[model samples]
Target: MKSVGVIIGSIRDNRVGDKVAHWFFEKSGVKKNLNAEILDLKKFNLPFFNEDVAPMALKGNYSTEEGRHWYNTVKKFDSFVFVTPEYNAGMPASLKNAIDYVYPDWNSKPAVIVSYGFHGGVNSALSLERIITDKSPIKMNLTNTKPKLFLSKDILNEKGQFKNIDQDFEKYTDEIKKSIEELEELLNTATANK
Candidate 1:
């Protein structure tokens, strides 16, 4: 089975990215070919990039202890699904730092970014798309922004737990499902090329 990393891309307290990642993984885990695991960056305490060279040029030998461990964990996956939220119309700094910490680990691999926020975090997804495109490790398998996963007004309650997110979003859910199906084809093509 191929390991699929479900990345929770936000580190803000009460950030719903982790919840969405868990929900997505629970759903994705039912797939017979995918072994989904949540790769939470919050647990890693990685520092901002301070190495002498870019991660791509490091040849995968990360400089810091946290960086090395982060690289290794990311390397274990065949593909990734980034669950992120927009902050100031961009992705969180920590998520960007996490991506900057590695190079070779994501080469030619597929990344499906699932973002949520007012208007579905489309801006953040666009920002992320540009970042990923400029890099060589991972490729965007699907880039469409369907805000079905958008952080709805009542999505979370007073206690900061999910309420509306667990239910289906009708047509939007179908669209999201279709996008995931496209990943199977992407994986096949990637495997063949490799």
Candidate 2:
């Protein structure tokens, strides 16, 4: 079994990311292969990358206590599920900052991105896919479902509460299961090399 962290990547007031992450945390835990936990970035309260040297060059060491805590927390996870919101067609700056603050902690780890928004957050998820897969070097496993809430009146009244309820979610659930299975394989491969 692996320790999986579902990261709540937004820090704004009444944000939907936390709600989404909590939901994912529960869903992931039922999987026998994973020990899922919620990692809220808001709790970390990391300042902008105040380091003189990038974490990538430092071999994942850090100069600040906040940075050290963040790195240590992330290091425990064999896989991740990032619950993010689309901000201006991209992920929140806070999320991007968190990613910038770390390095090898994410290396070779598989990340399943779950983004929700008016347009299903596909654009933000796509942008995030680039960051995790290209820039951060985390494996970007994704769900085809995209998780969109389509009605303006219905959503504004509910205030993103739709995620709190369990829907069919069959497709997304299947994708998540697949991601965990593949991630375990990757983890085994890494261990085998050692």
Candidate 3:
């Protein structure tokens, strides 16, 4: 089975990113083919890019302990699902900061976007794709999830939970499964070549 890192990009207190990621994993039900793990950025507590080096790759000296931890965490996964929140029509700075902390770990891996916010976080997802492609050269899966997450209140139940949202959840779940399957195939091909 292939391992996928489901990265929750929001670092805010009481954020909904984790809940949504968990929901996606549950809905996907692709454990036989893919192993999914949620990687929350808040736990890393990484500082801003403060290294004196002009380029991060040459020095590779992470300024703080959090940076080292974050880099190690990122290196563990072969693929990623960046669950991002739109902030001012783009991804949050914390997510971008986390991405900047690592280099080679992100290269050659596959990535998929699961974004949410007003306008379904489409703008943020697009911007993130550009950044990831430019920096890591990772394959960006066409299958994506862009839930209109602002409707959480309406879709969620009385216990503040969203168990099912009609056919939308099913559709998103199918997309995730397809993306992971493609990623697994790509990973296998890459491994064979090596």
Q: Which residue pairs clash in candidate 2? A: none
Error of 3 at 45 (Å): 1.4
- Specify the highest-TM-score model's number: 1
Q: What TM-score do all the candidates reach, one by one?
A: 0.86, 0.81, 0.81
- lDDT string for model 3 (141-161, tens) is 333433434444666667655
Which scores higher on TM-score, 1 or 3?
A: 1
Off by over 4 Å in 1: 29-31, 134-148, 168-172
Task: Please name the candidate that would achieve the greatest lDDT relative to the true structure.
Answer: 1
Expressed as tens digits, the lDDT of each residue in 23-43 for candidate 2 is 555664425766877888999
The 10 consecutive residues of candidate 1 with the worst lDDT sum are 139-148
- lDDT of each candidate versus the true structure: 0.73, 0.70, 0.71
TM-score order of candidates, best first?
A: 1, 3, 2
lDDT over C-alpha atoms for residue 72 of model 2? 87
